[model samples]
Target chain A: EDQVTQSPEALRLQEGESSSLNCSYTVSGLRGLFWYRQDPGKGPEFLFTLYSAGEEKEKERLKATLTKKESFLHITAPKPEDSATYLCAVDFQGAQKLVFGQGTRLTINP
Target chain B: GAGVSQSPSNKVTEKGKDVELRCDPISGHTALYWYRQSLGQGLEFLIYFQGNSAPDKSGLPSDRFSAERTGGSVSTLTIQRTQQEDSAVYLCASSLAGTDTQYFGPGTRLTVL
Candidate 1:
């Protein structure tokens, strides 16, 4: 079965602190890996899509890097505004199904 | 309108009551999807619709959960005789195509007491 696991379940960082969130997965084949930001009481907002190992993408203060078996979302100089649940998901080959990780809830105290 | 939107942002009902959640996707988007997110958990795929083809319902947890898309624009997820375990935020999303990246809506939080 395709599955995704996120580590550190939760993280607390001081303002301007930098850290990384990890997402590991097992799938038949990787079509694409996606990263999303979700706020309380809201749906996820698309962040980045990494298609191959060694690939990376960035947006504002967030950066996503992918490997054959896992992906990491790095936040640089994060602010309280960046605090939210970061989710990583991979689309399984041969289907529209996307297996999602449990997600990392990052809190940046201002 | 501007992006994917779900109706009835918050719902509270007793167990065994039927509930319907609505999702309006962006115009011209050919692919629509539904998912459920429980408190402190990840998103779980529920269903998928692409254009006029039959939807992918393999992810639906049970027969009690059913859905339909009308005119390729608005989709509705109907949970019949809902259970307390069904308490979760029902999310809707859409993409240009089933193979493309998807955009999500605000989600409807259902609280089954």
Candidate 2:
């Protein structure tokens, strides 16, 4: 069965703190890994799509790196505005749908 | 361009009432998707529509749930005899053809009494 798991269910970071969130997956054939940021009462916003192992993508203070079995979203010196639930999803080759992980709730104190 | 849009930002109704939720995907997007998210759970896939091809309905939770994408643009999800378990935030997303990145719309929060 294809499954995605995100660790550190909740994290509280002070402003300007750096941390990483993990997303591990088990799938038949990896197609793509996606990261999204969802704020309260809003829909999720697309962040990155990592298609292969050793691939990395960055945006401002956020960077996402992928591996064979997992992906990491590293936040560099995050600000309070960066606080949101980070979601991870994997698209397997044959599934044609995304399997999402229970998101990591991040709170950056101002 | 406008992003995906969903109607009735919030809805509350009796348990047995039927409900319809609408989604307007981004203009020119060829792929549309529906999902549900409970208060504390991750997004659950419900259905997918791609162009004129048959939609992937494998993710629909039950026969009571059905969706239709007309003219390959606007989509509607209909739930017959809604149950408390069906109370959730229904989210809609769309993507360009042959792409994995999906953009979502502000979800519709449904509550069953």
Best by DockQ: 1
Tell me the docking grade of candidate 1: high
DockQ result, candidate 1: 0.83
Provide the overall lDDT of each model, using Cα atoms, as 2-decimal numbers. Answer: 0.91, 0.93
**True contacts preserved, each candidate?**
0.77, 0.74
Once superposed on the true structure, which residue ranges of model 2 sit more than 4 Å away at CA? none
TM-score of each: 0.96, 0.98
Write down the worst ten-residue block by lDDT for model 1 chain A. Answer: A91-100
Give stretches of model 1 more than 4 Å off: none
DockQ of 2: 0.78
Question: What would the per-residue lDDT of candidate 2 be over residues B1-113, giving only the tens digit for each residue?
Answer: 89999998999999999999999999999999999999889999998889746458898999999998899899999999999999999999998963558899999999999
lDDT of 1 at A100: 86
lDDT of 1 by residue, A1-110 (tens): 88899988999999998999999999878999999999988899999999999999989999999999999999999999999999898897787867789899999999
| lDDT, model 2, position A30 | 90
Top TM-score prediction, candidate number: 2
Candidate 2, residue A110: Cα displacement in angstroms equals 1.8
